[model samples]
Target: MIILFRIRRWLFKYIYHLIIILSLPLISLFSYNHLLNNHYHPKLINYTTLNQLYINNNTLFDNLFHSNKITSKFPISERSFSSLNDDVFQYGCRDPIMESSKNKRLNAAFVVLARNTEIDGVILSMRSLERRFNQWFNYPWIFLNDEPFNDEFKSRVEEVSSGEINFGLINSLNWHFPNNLENSPFFNEVVENQGDRGIMYGNMKSYHNMCRFYSGFFFEHPLIKDLEFYWRVEPDVEFYCDLTYDPFLEMKKNNKKYGFTITIKELINTVPNLFKLTNKFIIENNIKLPDTWSLFSNNMKFFKGENEINYKDVKNLDDFFRNLIKNTKYNYAKNVINNNNSDNDKQIPSKLLSKLNKLIINHSNSLPKSINEKFNDESYNLCHFWSNFEIASNELFTSPQYKAYYKFLEDSNGFFTERWGDAPIHSLAAGMFLNLSEIHYFRDIGYKHSTIGHCPYNSPNQLPYIPSDKFKHQVLPQDEIYMSEIDPPIKNPLINSNLGASGCRCRCPSDHREVENSGGSCSSLWLKLNDNNFPNSNSLTNHQLNLDLIENWALNSLMDWINNNGNIDDWEISQSERDLLSKNVI
Candidate 1:
């Protein structure tokens, strides 16, 4: 039995990896005809050239291995544990007067989509989180689906959670796209030409935007406001920590508003002079910048690009922002520009100040959207948006911020239509503007929900469904039920007393504890059935089967699922055939 189990596990591992790497579309072209739906009667032999895309090929085993990278042990020093009080990371130090702690740990829930096989790891990670922070969680749980949360999925999830797990019914109207909008010119052109190459390109663009727009603005919607931190748990993700700390407070205290696990450059050309524009704004508003805002350093030295661009010249967006920090007006340095000697570099002065001002003036005169102060309004800071990781606040999603970030970057996609993702865009924005103290890496602490071990913890060997005794520390409610009421929001420190801004960790840690840490879905099978995930004949058939289930004309959740669910079976059509079918169906 042991040998058989090991064999089964190995088989599952390789098979799953191969499937993702080779792709269902490729599999169908080579082998899966038997899985095709019966009614795919096509009138013509659809064949078109697939514009093959070449990416920096990441391998199957490496991809899988990367998922296991979080640390299993905390990296704190002996001095850390001995000198620091728990109050820094924990909810309270027992300050009896101000109620010690507000005691408002969220009854946070997760909404994950799954299909094919049962996903067991995600729930297990959550169980671990509850056990380590039971005293902090004061809320319920919710699970949703594009399909019914089968008894198997629900029971298994609840069993591991050790808490009430409520399953939500995704109304079809809320789940799928309505078959109207054929009247609107833009959307109509999108629909009518979908069968032509015209539609596939557009749908792909629109679908990508759907995720980006949501990541950028989901907080304003009524659906998730009650929950303070919605830790997005996707299928096949991992976690590894006791999580004795509360991230929400970290976000609150240091004003490390937006939290992300990974950072990457923005698509070039999306916002070319983004940096120059920011400098313009700062100078105009006379906002006090970090002290290190100087461009050059040393005894008459030559830094590359020092003659033209004040900061070191760079080819990638990451380097550009990395250089921006020195010119930032509010850092560890207080002297705006103190080189004890006379400097005559024109480029140096611009990068330090003038270039950014130029962008501000140009943008101010160019667009209305860029002019709105609400563009920087704090109300929209989504406390739980994730790109490669979680972003806690609205600290990085400003228009001018994005505009200033793309100076050295260019959109990979030539048209620039499907270029910047919210994650990359915001990362650049924060990189150029955020103070290092304002960014909490939680290196010593960790979390469990990110992919490739970008989180704070270790990946458990058990399935996502297993709620082992290791997770016993979590506190659970007796009733496997949830109240239909929304949770009261955790108070916003920046909004209440501060003027749309939270104080930074600008100073040093008062306690040693403040020093210890850092660390740290598909629902669908909840997606609507789209043929592209299947091979040609099979995909054609599933399209007809799912036709009647459509609903919600605007934020059509079905359209999203069809576009994203990794059924892979959909991408099997010959490039031309896929285009024709995608255009007509989507």
Candidate 2:
């Protein structure tokens, strides 16, 4: 009886192996035919139709990624698998290194500010931009550095790119520390105070030089002067979508002067003196002030039924303001924030107001008195466009108005005596000089640098059916969503906030935590899909069938599939096709 049972087990195992071997070719043919016919219904999609759809979907992904709705470990599910199909097509096509379009009208290039040590990061950013957007347009790229780029850095970048490339060195004059101040008491005090504050690069003279150069000198560089527009790219940044349309052309058509993807409040400590300096500039240059400027002034006359200040006193206010800041501690107001525990107690008190009155600026009695409240207002020095990703008219930076504005600030010596970031400097230039119509928020472009990312939350199609755990540290801000006719009302962030909380290190808000012991769809799906030792109870023949199918699809082309199957459309995608692609078989 034992001999008979052993013989029977051996026979079963052998038959299973034979069946898997016999079915491999048939499975491959089926998967090939399914992928070819599934979405290739001419009426539904072709390369042209899919290209436009991919662009729109890519924009949605931008918003999704930025909001941290997706993360590095996130996996594509059945629903999202189709959305990412363009990426597969791009890989399979081995598309030619596209030549610049002969009829391309806009003269634009990507400008990179980087160091030689950052070559690897720069290459990665370049590859992403090329794969996502620039490959088709073939826009030139200009690399700028304080020091000359080495031969190796130039060669690597050139090899990866087909576009015209130019490398330039930052002029020393633009990078020079403010002169005649080596022994100045105030300058030394500023440096010492900054070092004590623990601000990143606060004590570094090179960082200050870089900030000042970018503020007033980059667009003036000889390499960029001939171009009408530029897209500022940096090392290690990511571009996450297929940019089917030309953004430079979009800027030209719409008459856009500046475009940015992210805007956040700047650290108040970095620019304590910036607002005062700006006021002085307005007075010296006789620059027309925007209505929002009233937000900074305490004059009741500007408000109906409020008292007005003496016009003469306000005009001669520069010296008084200078004296106040000179007497004030560096970043004094910001330090007060850390000393105080309650946000509601943030109003500038009577003593501070009395002094500020002499300077013609007062936050007391303002509609929103605290930094957190009026953060988006131009009067608030804390508001700024994140400048890492910028698309703008070259004229915006080189125009006479901007030059005069920058010169006025430079003369104040704020760049060295105080830490002023280029982000706020660029933000102020756009906010103060350009009309609202000329400034654009490019929510369509997906961008990531460091920890923060953003995507437009407008289209329902833009969001995944399943939320990603990427926003584990910070809950997605609901207010950022822009509802459209087609977009579904935004999902409640709280729903997914707690899905995997037990493992998350972040101290997120309590309301945002996942329900105890309950794993939501995103977390559950992530485990099932990503675990290398995923539990499987399938027969050997079925496993072999899936492996063969995926292998045939990736190595073969759509043409090969179509040749085998003949003309067909609207066929259902096979289970193997969906699983294989989502599992990274292709």
Candidate 3:
């Protein structure tokens, strides 16, 4: 009886083993389908956990083999999962050195103007550039400081950077009071007495040196001389989106000479006589250049007697029109006004003259305010391209016109005595020498310095803090055709062309108008994602897309709301966790 019982147990064990082996393929099939179907989606967990499951720990053979039931609501498919392989990922990230063909293309590098004290902030900026744009480009970085970079600063920056890193000391001559000004009593007195002038950086000798270097010598630095294009990066600036294509390549292909992310009006006090100096330089140098509107030439022959032509002094509308054509200082100005006129000035109709007189009188008073009343033809309040973030062709600086312009400004000693910012200087040069077509506004770039900031995401779903003056800060003309705002979710054309166009259809039933009408902040953003007509709505279309990011952003919003509304402890919390926090131990 005992032997029979042992036989029965052995038979039962054999049957159980056989059944388990037979079900193995079925279990694998079910799990494979579950992964393929994207059913096991996690709702609200920290991004660390999500990244671990999604990005890092990709291999899960044990879990797949043991569990017969389908799990995992994550939307990842086989294609998405496999693409994260180191080789695939790195190749897609655009390492220019690896692609032999790109080497023969444009010579470009990132130029960082900073001091040794700003090394930490510089590293952060570099890391952001690498992750967003430069990793693929593998563009070299040139660091310039008025003072020599310390070893620690050099090593730390090198460690975080993937591309070639170069450190350069500003020429002592470039960073000090010029030989002409060093012995001047006036310069010394102004530097000493201007400390309390309330002008930003007006009194700092070092600041003057910094501005002078950028204006006259940054592009000429030996480390930067070979590159045809340089993207100026500042310490602590952030890049908000992924850049798939090479911006340098775009600039080269499109013949873009000057690119700026932000443009703001310079303080009037900072560049009080900048326009007078610029006009004098243009006139004295005999420089003539073509721009978007008309040819700007140092040829003052156009307005030789403009100030003397008193329109109000004319006796009648017919007399005003007659004198305007005959006594005008510039033939070009007269032709522009009288092209529609009849051949006989004597027979000019009263009706036409009345209209012409009104137009002249109205526009005469409404003309743009000029820095110098004598040079009212050229208005200058120092609207400049912020040099803090700029990308430009080397020719913009290296050309004869630009070189002469810089030399003229350098000789005047305005940089030392007044707080002349490099931004205004660069902007004025570009505006005068380069065509509007050559000047591009990088509206998509996320830029911030000190108190000001800008993001391309017009309605950001996830920014931690929004600048109060974001909408008010006028970087470009409101109606500028080329500088139009591209709504979020669409891959910035400046970043990627195909990715944005391939995004999903808007899933929202209501349009952007409806979303705006809703009037709630988060709700409006959410509805914008759903509005199909809205650009980049596909950025949020996928069910499992960026879920962790969204959740984290939502949590941040909740915390902010709670903080702004009342005490943090007002929210539901376990008594044990609170007690542990109060005692500093469990």
**Model 2 over residues 1-586: C-alpha lDDT tens digits?**
9999999999999999999999999998787554333320001111233225324522222222211333222311111221110111111111222213434748889999999999999987887676555656678889999898999999989866647899999887777764657457877778777978986677887788888888888888999888899999989976533344566886777777887766656676788778767766776777775422321322211111111121112111122222222223222333444444357555656664444343233332322323332221224525567788998899888888888888888888888878899988887777568654566555445566775554322221232222112111111132112111122222324332211111101111212222111222122222222223222321011122223333334334333443576221212234344333323321
Report the C-alpha lDDT of model 3 over 333-396, residue by residue, as the tens digit. Answer: 2333475464754553576455445555654564435423335243453345668889899988
Comparing 1 and 2 on lDDT, the stronger one: 2
In candidate 2, residue 548 scores what lDDT?
37
Put the candidates in TM-score order, highest first: 3, 2, 1
lDDT (C-alpha) at residue 488 in model 2:
24
Assess candidate 2 and give its TM-score to the true structure: 0.51
User: Over the stretch 1-586, how does candidate 1's per-residue lDDT look in tens digits?
Assistant: 9999999999999999988987967866554233221121111111111101111122111111112231112121111111111112331122211221454544344444343154465455455445433323323455545467666677666655644566654444333333363234654444334335442334454443334433343433334445555544455443323333456655665566445443222333333333334444555555554311211001111122222233323222222223332232221112222331237443234443453345444533533333212122111111111353463453343345444433223322211233234444444345446543454443323333332232221211111122233244333341111111111112223222111111111111112121112222110000111112223322222232111121112113323433585221122222332223233332
Ten contiguous residues with the weakest lDDT in model 3: 78-87
The CA lDDT at 469 in model 3 is 17
**Model 3 misplacement above 4 A:** 1-105, 292-376, 458-586
Candidate 2: residue 223 lDDT (0-100) = 91
8, model 3: CA deviation in Å? Answer: 66
What are the runs in model 2 whose C-alpha is more than 4 Å off?
A: 1-105, 178-189, 290-381, 457-586
